[model samples]
Each structure stands twice: as structure tokens, then as C-alpha cells.
Target: MNTKKQILALVAFSSLFISCTKNDIDIVPQNYTIPDTYTFDRNSTTSVDYSGQSSRISMLQEMGDYYKTQATAGNEVNETVLNNMYSNSGNPFSSTDLNTSGKQLKDKTAASTDYFTLLYGGGSTVEQASVRTFFQTQFTQGNNASLGNNAAVGVAGKYLDGTSTRLFAANGLEPQQVVLKGMMGASFMDQIANNYLSVNKLDAGTNVIDNTNKVVEAGKNYTTMEHNWDEAYGYIYGGDIASTNSFKFWSSYINQVNNDTDFNTLKAAIDLAFRKGRAAIVANDYTTRDAQIAIIKEKLALVPAVRAVFYLQEGKAKLITDNGAKAFHALSEGYGFIMSLRYTNKPGTNNPYFTKTEVDTMLNSLISGPNGLWDIDNISPKLDAISAQIATKFGFTVAQAATVN
Candidate 1:
């Protein structure tokens, strides 16, 4: 029983005592999990079952509606950078078509420079990180996982082998994939929506169809579908075989609805087929830039998070006149749904991250970094080329391409 022996004994006793005390049960009740005050009807918008109607088209349409609502809200957002995002003062369209008494009509902060005001004429301040955080959360947070899953966003995020022409040998994807990603995919969304919409109203015998994928009729004799219809023959209209996978041209499919025996059945069938079909295609093709963006109609539909923060950034720009507000707003979700609605990535880099170039140019074709496209000069100019790459890759206009730098 020397000092060392006594210390060891004391240590053993302490360990035993703590172990015994650790087992004491404290049964605290579990905390409550409350639902969000605002949430997109996931049940209504997303597919729980990949069964019949549970498809990508339905998902996109639902998400599209969500974006449309957000766009409406975003249009109303009037911060410094986007001070005029929702001005009713001069634009007759805003006065008559786009506004409601109490509701906010979200519009993209499209202008190079403009602004939106706070409620009751309150002014806006410019903060970059703050806006980016708010906007990113709006898209990535509790809204809908479908809207922000790693599945599509990260499907094929890797450096592309630097080439002169982003050619079409990805195999059967050859030339088509490029078109889908750059040309068709960019315009495909609205094009497909309108195509389906055209066929959506056709009657079979004694049935009527509505926007929702619902029907109220029966069938008779339907006609064969024709994808070569005048409406289905262009960049946005043309439904290129997105991948080696099964591709359905909803434009043609919807047009064939009249050929179906039951108008209601075809109506339901076509509506579900096209809207959900496109969505499904987009969902499946997320690995490719074109298809991924095609399904990502968030920008066109107008996400409020994107718009709000975008305007806030615009406000900063107005106050500072340095584009700091614009750049800062680019990062926020609630401030500007840029994260949710748009892809910011560009081409020619060793990274898969988005660039402001992509966000700036959606459909206008200006500078195509055609694989071995734009030649990079000095390091700074090469970085500027990333913006050009994005604009060209996504089919943006020359003007937009100029703006990206």
C-alpha cells in the first residue's frame, strides 16, 4: 500500500463510480417537429412513386409553377441593384398584366442595372455574402429536395477534356447532345410547354381537359402522332435524342392526342406524357448540361428567393455603382434565387463549378466554346474566357456574352 498503489486504487474507484453514474436514466421527452410555415406542396409537386404519372415532366411543371410563383415574387423585389425590378410607374404591362393589389409580381433582375424597393418605399442596402446566403438557402433548404438534389446537380461534375469542339461523340449523342445542351435544351422547356399546351386543349369526343394533369372524359379513335409538325422542327421545338436512352417528343405526342380514341384519356395521357415526359427526360439527362438545364426552369419561372436577393444586390450596385451588389446578390437564395433557378458554371476549366457566364446567357447563342472553341490568352483574359464559355455553351446572345466578362 505505497503511494503508487493507493493512487491506482483511487483511480479504479473513480472509474467505477463514473460508470455507475453514467447509467442513471434521464428520460426527457422528445422535442416537437413543426412543419414549415411555407413549403411547396411536395405531395402535389414531387413524385413519391415512380409509377405512372409520377414523372419528371410533372415534377418540372410543378417546380415550374413554383418558380413562376417565385418569379412573381421576385418581380416585386426592388432593392438597389434591381431597383426597377417591379416598377409600375411607367411600364404599362406591369400596371395592367403583371400586378395584383397585395401580391408581389416577381420579375428577374434582367436589366444590366435597375432596382426594386422595399415595402412602403423603404430603401435597400447592399451586402454580398448576406444576399448569397439567403438566396442559396431558399433553393437548397426545406423547400423541396427534388429542387436541390445532388443527383442532377452533381451527376457529371468533372473537368471536360479540353478540346476545340465540344463535339458529339459521347456516341449516339454525337451531334445531338450538343444541340440538346446548348440549343435545344435551352429553349426546350418553354417550347415543350407550349407544344403540350397546344395539344392539351384538343377534345376527343365529349371531354374537356385542364392544366392540371387531370381529365374529365372518355376516348374514341386517335390519330398517329407527327413529330415533324411545323411547330416541332426547330432548336427549342426539336426534341433531339437527348441521350442513348428512350426519348419522347412530347410536342409530337401531345399533337397525337386527337388521334386517341378517348379525348380525356389522351388529354390526361398527353398532359402527363409531355409535361412529365420532359421532366423525366430532364431528370434522367441531368448528367448532361442541356437536359439538366432543360428541367431546371427555375429561372424562367422566376424563383422569389433568386429575385429578392438579386434585387438586393442590384440595390448595392446602385448605391455603390461597382457591380459588387450584383456579384454579392448572385450568391443569396432569398435575396436572389440565382442558386435555385440558374446554373452558374462555365466551360474550359478543370473544375465543375458554375460561372456567372452561364447565369447571364441562357438561350441566346453568342460565343460557343466549341470544345476547342475560344482560345485562352493571358491568365486574366482566360478567366474572362470562362464567362464567354458559359454564354456560348448555353446559347446566349453576343450582347450577353459581352456582359459576362
Candidate 2:
């Protein structure tokens, strides 16, 4: 056995000598204490570093804001510019740090080992190209606004909303919502639940040895393992230790879900798991570290699942009232959230709650008709079935997730 396996075996053997409670079953080794917060240091210098993740988050913020600008009158989304931003090439971002950060969203979407590797097996290379298809469709459909056709079955243009307008494609789907919320799953959530948090990245090669020895990389403050863990946390919290403001993408939806009284405890629970897991890594308590990983996976998975149902409920109610603009907007968001479901971690398993095929099927069911949302006069039955499926997998009732603004 290797050093990590041997040490874990010894720890397991030693556990028989101590009586432990359920809460403390994975006892910390003696002489090392876990910090109350996510602070870790050696020689009095802090070792936390997730600057790479911070850069990507900021990149998405700039990119999403730029996409939203295309919705305005007489503005068009330049496909090449958006593509450049997605790849972070040709200095697409206005921020100097982001331009030089060398991080790009195009490479990260649906790129996690647990999601992409399992879903695509060895076919991950082609999957990257396939994922960028969303960008092409977003710009293609969004640019349709300049055509001045009122959005309908095969027409793409403005959807009027109480004197204002939101751009919609021929199928009543907002182009930006599809790409933005799709990235919430394909990039942010996938990286956290599947890529950085997975053992493939966390304990790969000498990561455990390096982290356990406090052997910081040359010219860097943190060990490889420490950096990997923080990267996962950064995706959700955006490197903001307080996690209170400036929320974007997945963090924005997480905050949205947390605001609902039915699911108010989610943010705190997820934040605590991240903090405790980082502390456990510092203490060399791999058992506790792994346990916290499970908690993070399971909790993070629910954010997408609950939000998918919530948006669907919102769309169904608005559609019932014959509000086309509001209904399409809600349903478009629901569509993106459902697309996100394939990226969720199912706890103790590398698989997501739903497969890519399953998510695609659900998405197709939503907009299967020629008219899409425009044709669906009564969408409650379809919405309820999709919501119930999502809620059932997460062990919550659709009614529970649907009871909010």
C-alpha cells in the first residue's frame, strides 16, 4: 500500500481503542487542532489561494453582463467576441487581471471527471466541442431580435413585458438564460462537485503527501491539495469569505434558494461543510475531510434540483395567468436549471442525480412542440411531472419547493 493507504489503515486500526460518538466518529489525530475558520498557515503566513477560481468567476461575470447588453435595442451579440471571451483569448475581457489570468470558461464546462468522464467515458475531448454549441445557438437566436419579428412558433424577436421587453428565440427561450444558467451547471457546479472535490484531483499523485507535510509549492503559499479544495469552495463562494454580496451564477441561485423559508438552512450547511473540510485537510484528518466532501456533494447537488423545480413552478403559474413574457422567462430559466441537473453529485457516488440523456429528455419534453412555450396553453401537468421527478430524487416534495415567490 502507498503512504496514504497505510496511514488510513493505521488510523482505522487505532479507532478500536477509542469510544466515539456519531458526531465525532472520525476523530482527529492528536497534537493537531482544526481551526474554527478556514484559516490555514505555516510560519505565520496564510496558505489559502483560490485566485484561479476567482479569475474564472470574474470572467463569467464580464461575459454574462456583455451578453445581457445584447438584449438592448439596436445592439447585436458578436459571436466572435463572445467566443473569444469564452476562451479568454485575444484579450477579450476589459479587466487586466482577467485578461492575463489564463483561465477560461469554455474549457471548464462539463469538464469535470465525475461528470464528463463518467458521462462521456473516454469521449471527453469531443464533448468540449459539443458544449460550445450552446454559445453558437445563444448568439444565433439572440441576434434574431434585430429581425423585429414578435416571438412565436418559428419567429424570434422581443417578448413584451409590461412596457419593457426581453429577447426570446423562436421557441420562447431566452438565449442568455440558456447559456448563463446552463453554465451554472456545466461549469461552476460541475467543477465543485466533480472535478476539484473528486479524489482524482484532491489526492492525485503526491497531493496528500504535499498537503500533509505543509510543503507549499515553490513560489506559492499553498499545497496542491489545499489549493484544489479551495478551488471547489471558490466556485460557490467566489473567494468571498463572508459570502454575503456580489453573488453571481451558482452563488446567486444558492442565495435565491437559501432565501426560501422551506430551504433556508442550505447555504449555512454548505458553507460549514466547506469550512470544516478545509480545516480537516489542515489537521491531516482525512476521514473527516472525506465525510465533509460527501456533505458538500449532496448539498451542492440540491441547489440545482430545487431551483429547477422552483422555476418550473414559477413558469406554470405565470402561464396559467396567460402572461407570455413572464411565463417564457420563467420557463427559460427552468429549462436551464433542468439542463443543470446532469451535473449534480448524488453523494457517495460519482454519478449525478440525473444523466445527461435524462436531462436532455426532460428539456425536450418542455419545448418538444413546434411552438414551444407559445403552444403549451396549459403547462401545469408537464411542469408538475418534471418537478415531482426532481423533488423525488432529492427526497423533497414538489409542494415544498413550489411554495415561494
Q: Can you give the lDDT of residue 262 in candidate 1?
A: 30
lDDT of each: 0.25, 0.78
- Can you tell me which runs of candidate 1 are displaced by over 4 Å? 1-177, 183-187, 197-374, 378-405
- Candidate 2 lDDT score relative to the true structure: 0.78
Best model number under TM-score: 2
**Candidate 2, position 1, lDDT:** 88
Candidate 1 residues 104-201, lDDT tens each? 21211110010112111111233223333333333332123222222111121111112211111111011112211221122232232222222221
Clashes of each: 84, 0
